[model samples]
Target: MRAVRFEGVGRIAVQELEKPAPGSGDLVVRVEASGICGTDRHILRGEFSSRPPVTLGHEFSGIVEAIGPGVTRFKVGHRVTGDPNIACGLCPSCRAGHVNLCESLEAIGVTRDGGLAEYVLVPEKQALSLPADLPPLYGAFCEPLACSIHGVDIAGLRPGMSAIVLGGGVIGMLVVQLARLAGATRTVMITRQAAKRQLAEQLGATASADPSAGDAVFDICGPGGLLSGGADVVFECAGVPDTVALAPKLARRGGAAVILGVLRPQDRVEIAPLELLLREVRLLTSFLNPFTHARAADLIATGAIDVAPLVTRQIGLEEAPGVISEPPPAGEIRAIVVP
Candidate 1:
């Protein structure tokens, strides 16, 4: 089997490895598709915590090739999407139903061998069934959509509310459509890329803006602006200091701001605590997908969320290392690795 390994900081490559067999209560998935994520780049650069010498692909889906003893929910030949986050059931967070915040959380691709190979072992509980007839490549989006579902849940968006999504990448794009489905009457996407801005509008953003323009803030929130009083909820999806700092500023008074981006552990951002306090704005952060993977699978299988446009390019396992080594190409939303 060929696998893309994250050897260490600033090092990643494709290597031949033995195909995995299912352990007890596990399923061995013959990987169909895996999407390259920003976190993959962060892991390679040592900006995010990860276990090296491991296969590096967290957002992936495949067909069940084999099942181990005690596995009952799945069988060989089932198409499935793997939820990579594994939480210790005994942890305080898990007991409280906040499994995403488990004290002893382990992740596939980050801490264990993942689906960036010919075969990857998935615990039975972590695998969510996908429709057999659905396009295999689209199942790769379930993980990301699940994470975005968690963000939308945290935001508590309501009908007729306004939303501003910062960044036009996969997370940002998924959020745009989710916000509309959540009944957000007005949705705005802010990013530097003109192509992404156009795509966002097509994907249900009521409007779009280029943050690179100096007057974006005033243009969107100032008097006579598109969102004259700012949005009811703002989502920072770029995972950068600038967007983090700008999220709250784009929220209306008494509104909320949700940080869905993953920044480096050492990264810092400047924010105005007094302003947030005065306006009663809630600044919240959404982490991993806690219990939304199933909904993501349903959405993808039913064609409720448009993921076909989200896939910008497709490459083989041989091209995975090089693509992850470099920044995403201009106008690229996602690059799927077909192993």
Candidate 2:
């Protein structure tokens, strides 16, 4: 089997490795499609925390080649999406139903062999079945979409409300659709790229804005602006300091700002405490998909969320390392790796 291994910081390559077999309570999935994520680049650049000497793909889906003993839920030949995050059920957070915050977390791709190879082992608990007829490439999006679902869930969006989504990447685009489904009547997607702005509008954003053109905060939240007095909910999906700092400011008084972006570990941003205090704003952060993977799978299987537009490119497993080594191409949303 060929696998993309992250040897260490600033190092990643495709190497031939032995194929894996399912262990007890696990399933051996033949890799079909895997999506290259920003976190993969972060891992290569030492911007994100990951255990080296491991395969580096988390957002993937495949056909079940084999099943281990006691794996009764999934059978051979089933198409499934794996929830890469493995939480210790005994942990305090896990006991409290906050598995994403488990103290002992082992994520596939980040901590162990993942779906970047010809085959990867997935614990039975982490495997969620997708429709047999679902496109293989679309199944790869279930992981990221699940995470976005968790973010939208935390935002508590309501009908007839307004939402502002920062960034126009895959996460932002998916968030836009989810926000609309969550009943956000007025959804605004802010990004500098003209193409992405147009894409956002197509993906349920009521309007789009270019933050680089003018004062983004004022143009979107000022009096007589799009939302006039700011949006009821704001989502920071750019994973940058600027967007993180601007998220709360874009929220209306008594509104909520949800941070769904994944920032570098050492990065920091300054905020105005007095302003947040005066406005009584709620600043919240959503981590990994805690309990939303199933819903994400259902949404993708039923064509409830449009994911076709988000897949901008597709590459072979041989090209996976190079794609991860370099930054995404201009205006690229997602690059799927077909193994």
Candidate 3:
């Protein structure tokens, strides 16, 4: 099998490797599609902790080629997507159903071999059977969708509320849909890319704004910087110093500010503590998918999310190296690698 192995910080190579054979309690999947994530970029740059020489791809789906001993839930030819967060069921977080916080975790792509190959092995506990009608390609989206679900859940969203998502990436796009479904009457997406702005409009964004220009939403979101009012909720999905720093000024008094972006290490943002003290706003952060794989798949299978629009490119495994190092244009929303 050929796999994309992460050699170390700033190095990833497509190397011909031995195929993964199912072990005890393991399921060997012949990967059909793998979604490239922002985390993959972090893996490439060595920003995140990943075991060296590990093949890196977590968001994926494939046919079950073989199953290890005691694996009875699935058989050869079953289509599935799965929970990438392999956790110790005995851990406190796992016992509480917050397996995303599991202390002894072995995430497929991060800690072990992932799906950026012809075949990848994972624990049977992590694999979930997809609806027969669901396309295998959409399975790659489950992980990110699960994370967005967690974010929306943490926002404590309610009907007829307003939301401002500060980035137009895949996560931001998914967040917009979730917020609208949660009954947010109006949703605004802020991004520099015109294509994303337009796509957000199609996905139920009431308004799209360019961060460079002054907009009234600023009054709602940029209160301390240049206005008197802020939005009911502000989600910082663009993980940048400017964006993170600006998030506080964008939330309405008593509103919620959710940081959805992953800040690079040593990054710092200057905030107005006194203003935050007066605004009564809530500063929040959402991390990985919180054991929400089931809901994410249902959301996709039910056609609540039109993932067809987000998939801009699909390439073969041979192209994985170049695809990861130098991605397509900014207009390319999502790319799927088929092995």
Deviation (Å) of 192 in candidate 2? 0.6
| Candidate 2 worst ten-residue window by lDDT | 212-221
Q: How would you encode candidate 1's per-residue C-alpha lDDT over 1-339 as one tens digit per residue?
A: 999999999998899998887789999999999999999999999988898899999999999999999999988999999999999999889999999999899999999999899889999999999989999899999999999999999999999999999999999999999998999999999999999999999999999988878897558888998889889999999999999999999999999999999999888998879999999999999998999999999988998899999999999999999999999989999999999
Name the regions of candidate 1 deviating beyond 4 angstroms. none
Of 1 and 3, the candidate ranking higher by TM-score? 1
Worst 10 residues of 1 by lDDT: 210-219
Candidate 2 regions exceeding 4 Å error are none
Ranking by lDDT: 1, 2, 3
Query: In model 3, which runs have C-alpha deviations exceeding 4 angstroms?
Result: 95-97, 215-228
lDDT of each: 0.94, 0.92, 0.84
lDDT of 2 by residue, 1-339 (tens): 999999999999999998887789999999899999999999989888888899999999999999998999998999999999999999899999999999999999998988888899999999999989888999999889999999988988889999999999999999999998988899999999999999999989999998888686567788889899899999999999999998999999999999999999888999999999999999999999998999999999999999999989989989999999988888999999998
lDDT of 3 by residue, 1-339 (tens): 998888998888889998778888889999988988878887888778889889999899988999999898999988888678877889888999877788897888888889888898978888888876687789898888898888888888889788888988888898899988899887888888888999999998888888877764474445353223666778888777888887777777898888988777778988778888898888889988876888898888888987878898998877877888874577877789988
Query: Once model 2 is optimally superposed onto the true structure by TM-score, how far is the C-alpha of residue 91 displaced, in angstroms?
Result: 1.2
Pairs clashing in candidate 3?
219-229, 220-230, 220-231, 221-250
